[model samples]
Target: MTGRRGPTLLSLGLNRARDTVTAQTPVTDLDEQTARDELARLAKVLGGANAAYHTSDDPVISDADYDALKRRNSEIEAQFPGLKRKDSPSEQVGATPSEGFSKVTHAVPMLSLANAFDDTDVVEFDGRIRKYLGLDGAAALSYTAEPKIDGLSLSLRYEKGELVQAATRGDGTVGENVTANARTIHNVPQSLNGAPDVLEVRGEVYMSHPDFEALNARQAEAGQKQFANPRNAAAGSLRQLDATITRARPLEFFAYAWGALSEPLAETQMGAIERLNALGFQTNPLTIICDSPEAMVAHYRDIEQQRASLGYDIDGVVYKVNDLGLQGRLGFRSTTPRWAIAHKFPAELAWTRLDSIDIQVGRTGALSPVARLAPVTVGGVVVSNATLHNEDYIAGRDNKGDEIREGKDIRVGDWVQVYRAGDVIPKVADVDLSKRSKDAPVFEMPHSCPQCGSDAVREPGDAVRRCTGGLICPAQAVEKLKHFVSRSAFDIDGLGAKQVEQFYADGWIAEPADIFELRAKYGSGVQQLKNREGWGDKSASNLFDAIDDRRNIPLNRVIFALGIRHVGDAAANLLALHYATWDAFSAAMRTAQEGNPAWNDLLSIDGVGAVMATSLATTFNQAAEIASIDRLVAHLDIQTAARPDTAGSPVAGKTVVFTGTLEKMTRAEAKARAEALGAKVSGSVSAKTDILVAGPGAGSKAKKAVELGIETLDEDAWLELIAPL
Candidate 1:
């Protein structure tokens, strides 16, 4: 949420244009307080939209509505710059990376592009660029026009002609490490020739129309869920935790950009793209240099006419300054490059009848309402469902409880207009009151969980209602068990979702602990798994062997496999790396639950916040949960987190502490830098602390370091010491 930050690039370019604000008052007419409040609301809405689109690939709002709100935010900010929030949306690019994969911080931020909605906007964009460069009408300028592929963005890093890492565009700065999955893509090269010594190739990962259809056919044949669109399928495939799953998916890449280059590929954008093509990379054939704004728009129109025949999804055409030197001079805004703009196509709309509304509970017990609609074609795909977002959305309210759709609420048996432009999920755009049934009642969200019948509560500042059933809820339990054996967790080779569901139903396994006792309980009884309808002697043996194979697991895997809410793989790794051993982590959690300083220690681990700290404490405090964990631990040998190699790093494996206000950098940046250099960043100074970096206003921590005779360095000294890294 912009909270205090303000609006970001996602607010400007991610979606299509639509009127989201119902208030009649214009931005210029609003008072300062009203404007501030509106800005905050826009920030929250845009932030959530960004996360849903970038992190989950499930957007909750229509692209049009998102665009409208973003424009309004910009207007308000422009009229009142001093009222901008601390966490402005304008400062953010994408949501934080998901926890399923390792995090990779990009050498250069992958900024988003500003958008041009119409010919007027396009002309304005060109004028702005020319004006910024102080160019007159006589000075010739060139720009590149290419399809804006509606798929996931990827950055492939190469070192010395060898592919080193692949990452998604996560929050612009840090991304998910998808090297293994990227390697499985047919077009992603393992090695490159005539490439720079170090290069970060940026492109889109997409699925062709034919491949998407074929994959959907296979999914239907296998009784698996089909993808909503090619873009979604491509994104889901690329982000798969298992490389084998990614390998099975038909995905392709088109190189369009570069980051962190050792040497210039070419002086111009088109030339660079051609160079990429020569280096055995897929480049968009339609990309061309347009000498004028008229040429650019003409090319865009040509691409739009051929969009249906392209055999791939493209939501719009991207226009960029062709000259690399011009791009360098143009530079960037807060979260977008000033040298480029995306000219989006109009949104596709279709009318559908709302048949019914269904409630689905996620692993965390968030009750999501899905609108089941009569089969209708949206764009080219047949649509049967759309996301209702939350109860507020059904009641025609935005995240800030402001009226939307002219205060028109959604009801069953209503004729709804669905819209899908570039988003993976179709959104209910507007309701046709003329065709709505009079008897159709306004929908009411349930106060209890539909699955567990537990008390469902929506905490303050939270939009979704969550069930309080915890582990007792069957939906949560089953989902947790499935997640426990997921690719990043226990990863039992032969035990999958089907096996987990079957075992749970048969009373063979109720919890993760029961998984370890499988062979002991049913190895030679009448209840043996081999006697089951789908199991043979060999299959049953393999299942048991798979479970046994995971008896010795890494500490991080053990923590993540626990499926504690808010504790994802990345968070679990941080905890593991901090505590080193399972016993130490467990003991610390217990102490933290008892209101000891361990609670503060948990909070001090950089990314671990109070909410996450509370979740960890709550999980460890429960007797039932502790008992289950104890049983699970008894059957497994959890290894300690390995110390990183200290070959080139002086601070590797060392515990460092920072105290007081940092003048040179923010605390978060300082902590991140230390952690990146293989040093453990502790929140509090203790006997284990090897070095103390003290800034102005250093207090008790500094005194303690001095009393303990620990090595102490001022901010300047600390910076100088790690300057080599």
Candidate 2:
């Protein structure tokens, strides 16, 4: 219910304050610190969700849940504009392309759409568009309304009226090339007549309900796993490495939009869809032009009513400005277009009894509470478990001691309302206090680890309680080892999560270093791995080979594999690039633990916050962790972080900071361009900063840079300097 877009999506606005807080807190009530923390958590959660949905063709969270969190993040950023994070969700599109497929760079970025949850939100969306276009309430504004297909986005490129290539929208800018598999889709046309010389037709690749059910029946008969949903099935079928397999599956395409065109397709959005339909493409029949917001909302309601009978799944309805000229004038925000919005259907709710509350410790030692529910059908799925978020959630209080759920605590044996909307795991929406028994016990979080009995401590300004046992705890240790071999980490082919658990249970591999020692210890002896129950001689040999392959890993991968608290792949990459080498980074961490200047150095590296730095230092300073890391390093070759090809750029290897309002582009774009040219883009201007790009109303950072005698350049000068490329 708040205004969505800010002037800058990724700019480090005013001074940032940091504190852990829950997403349930109202935007109007949140302080700057809480807003910053909420943004950080949202960024991480959304990043992981995007990767799960796009890269793996599997979603971890439901669409409704994701939208709520994203909307909360946007509202918070709107209130505390200066606290926008560099890794803000508004700056990210889809996930990075997965492996196995060749990469393709989209000619035009495939951005996502903002969501309108309710009728009021939709009305506000229309109001925002009208206000932006200088139109009053009386001004006529037509929009194209259509079902937002719950399917994978695909772009088909045709040159000279011949189908050339097709790509999946991966991270918006770069995508995965699925040309062969796309050609097998029944609705896809091999050629286009009366089309532009070059055309990039954008649309959704989906599976109809009949097709999906049939495929699942075939899969069950063949002793294979049934698909979770139609969307996943379509994505998996289209991304098949074997085109023959894709041909065997039922997949369809619905052309709805255009990306790049040699000439204009149409003057209006509805006209463009008609033209695409004429050009041998299957456009949605439900797509219509609405003269007003009321008409658009009415169409959305009609579509929602017809959702069950539509054959294909549609999570929401999308409304786009019909006039091409007005759309161009509206332009775009960082990750979404201002001229369009998705009006989503409400989440489905069902009442179920809360069986019990269970605590599960993660790799990072945080204790997560889950609600065990009686089997109930919600949105066509039998959901027996729901996320409780944290202990505060169960206690009906947020991290800031603010009341939530009307200050009603959830209790076991109570009938809870579960809701599911395109979610793999449903959540408890409300507690039925009338159904609760007087003898029902209030759920309480354990002060000790359930797995290892380690002292569970909840720090100030932190939401979740953490086990202090470190690597000693069995749950944390096993999960940490699993993280070490994840796809982005060492990625030992023969050693997956199952294998890691087995090896740990067998007392063969304890830490990451133990993996590299397997060949030397168990290659030829009576205790060989070939003698194991599941592993064969060839499998053992291959496992060793895979371990050997990762002996020489990149610094970023190494840092991520360590699984230090608060240090994810992005943070690891930043640290790796900042330090360049493992020795420099490790030594710096060690020095920083002694309360020296190295602490400031670590803090100065843009994106490395105090909490993350403390975690790094704590990991390095711990004697047990150091020994483990030393052993691991002894068996591996750690490569230095590689720099971009900066051949002649003057700013290459120099630390540059941008401050205040930028006129040329979004702050994210400017930072990306600078990094592409091999310049280090830092958030704060420090003594080590080589240049400061200052715009109007440049604040403390600019003044500090001036006092420090760092080279200062305005927007025009900075652009000119980096223009020659």
Candidate 3:
């Protein structure tokens, strides 16, 4: 074996004796000890390499070295049953499950792709497709080759023209419902132009290079944790609980396929992409129409050579049967479409030394451990750090308390396996135990906050360690300030990350109060702000106008604009409705913080918890902060809440469900129109539903309407119902 041996003999759980040497040199020559050692070594190597590639946008290892190690790890696991670890590199999928988003079941399944590892695989795939279509070799067959976006796969459902739902590819059967979050993405149209009456378009939502860079820069400046790669950033952005938050994140969508459509698309794959583009959907621009698989291979080579120049991440090229009819004939097998195959670009891997481990605190106060590595590149990005996740992750320990790889430790200067997939954060997939330095030191998390030296306490039953410094901490303060000026917050124009940092550094603006005061010193005191290199007279006026325009912001915007921890847009809206005004809300928070009689009442709110209440109270308690708010109010106008229109309404508070395809208006328009007429638009049809607006090809919702005995209206009837009054 080329790696360290496992620990002293332990019970194998089977009826095997101690020192039980295999009579035939083991069924698989790689024993459990050897497998564990090799697996760990490979993981460390891959993990470190991935971190370098993503964080720095520079690659270190060649594609071949990474693939060989990955394949070897897979082989070893197959040969050694006892050595497989839960956190083993071989078991990792793409990224961790996104947080803060409600899980949704996809209406149409998002299928996985079949792979084409070599020319032979491509030829065999073509042969199978032709065989299924009963076509001879002489018959001309074409394929569409597109860059396989190695990012999260999602389906956007639209009725009429309005987007209603977005789902992840959860097991290909169901996925998380991230409709609100998906709507926030600018590239993801809320209402499509000339869209199909009903369409479920499948796309790979990714982060562009520019956006990813901006996001990371902001993270670094704020001293908050940064994503390892663009894919991770996109995934995290898309999975936010608040659609507003997701919307604020720089997310882009590229349509790749269709899920469920009311009407047939084009005759060929290329035609479908064109049709998608015409419908105002952002289709992958790299799609090429090829005469044969050879042409596809050529295109793949060209793409591989141009990979560095591409703005978005790509793992390989996907070759699909061009003819729609032929694709149908080819059908599907298991989780993949038989008519299509993804010819993956060779894996990008590299070698780097693990320098140290650092702990990062998230917005929610959960502490996460990250590995600092010698800067290197595995893919296109330069990765200096990789996620260690938690203490359990670092110890090579499993759920059962069994020491993984015989208690092998990941230490400083250890060569590690680094893997990257699209925008997913790079992770330490394995450790190269064979190359472990004798002088390498075991890694340990700090006992105190790395930034503020506050006691980092691990909450009971939690995996993360959090700083006790609260608002006073520099990292937290900077991040909170940034969040306050975010799009979902005050949304002040010209107060982007760079501008905010510049103003903060110059002491021109320390808090929100300083923003309103800028106009007060418009001429001399703040002359530099106007004459700043990027801030000309026109730009300065625009910034001031934007700020002035939002002076009298809505209650919900005010609440969210405060940047309270864990208080997202939805929570802010709920709080606004409960309190109705700033004074009442501030009083309530004070009472809750002081543990007064109203404290329980505060917690009684649906989503309010101890942490949220504490955060709210802490924010309101600061005199300077409160004074800043007063100053802001002096120059601002507060808008009153809009009253719901209910006069002479036919369906006031009536539960209505919409189904099928509508021709005249987009589903969003229809829903808004219905809501305006005092009806509540719901996703599913229930007994409580009074009316079901059925379009032309109504699906399950219509069926449910019949079962529930709800009155149904077709597209024309729905238009008639709302047209009169």
Candidate number with the higher TM-score (2 or 3): 2
Q: What is candidate 3's lDDT per residue for 1-725, written digit by digit as tens?
A: 00001111111111111111211123255445545655565566555444333222233343344455555556667777677666665543322233444566555656666667777888888888778778888899999999877556778999998898888765466566878778777778788787778899888888876778888898898888887567667776776666776777888899989988888778889998998888888887789998877888889887765554476677788998899988887777655688888887655443567878877765444568888976543454556788887776678775555776467667877777666543237777677788788877766767677767888888775566777775556665556667777888788887777777777767677667677777776553335666677777678788877777777788778888777767987688668766777767767776664457667777877568888887788877777667766776677666655535768877877888876545577667887787677676777777889999875335456667888788998878777776667
RMSD (Å) of each candidate, 1 decimal: 17.2, 14.1, 22.4
Residue 523, model 1: Cα distance from true site in angstroms? 41
**What is the lDDT, from 0 to 100, of the residue 4 in candidate 2?**
15
Off by over 4 Å in 3: 1-342, 345-442, 461-463, 521-526, 593-635, 647-725
| Span of ten consecutive residues with least summed lDDT in model 2 | 14-23
Expressed as tens digits, the lDDT of each residue in 110-162 for candidate 1 is 88888788999999998999999999877999999999887899999999999
Please report the TM-score between candidate 3 and the true structure. Answer: 0.47
In the range 158-191, model 2's lDDT, one tens digit per residue, is 9999999999999999999999999999889999
Candidate with maximal TM-score: 2
Alpha-carbon lDDT, every model: 0.82, 0.82, 0.69
Q: Cα miss at 547, model 1 (Å)?
A: 43
lDDT of 2 at 164: 93
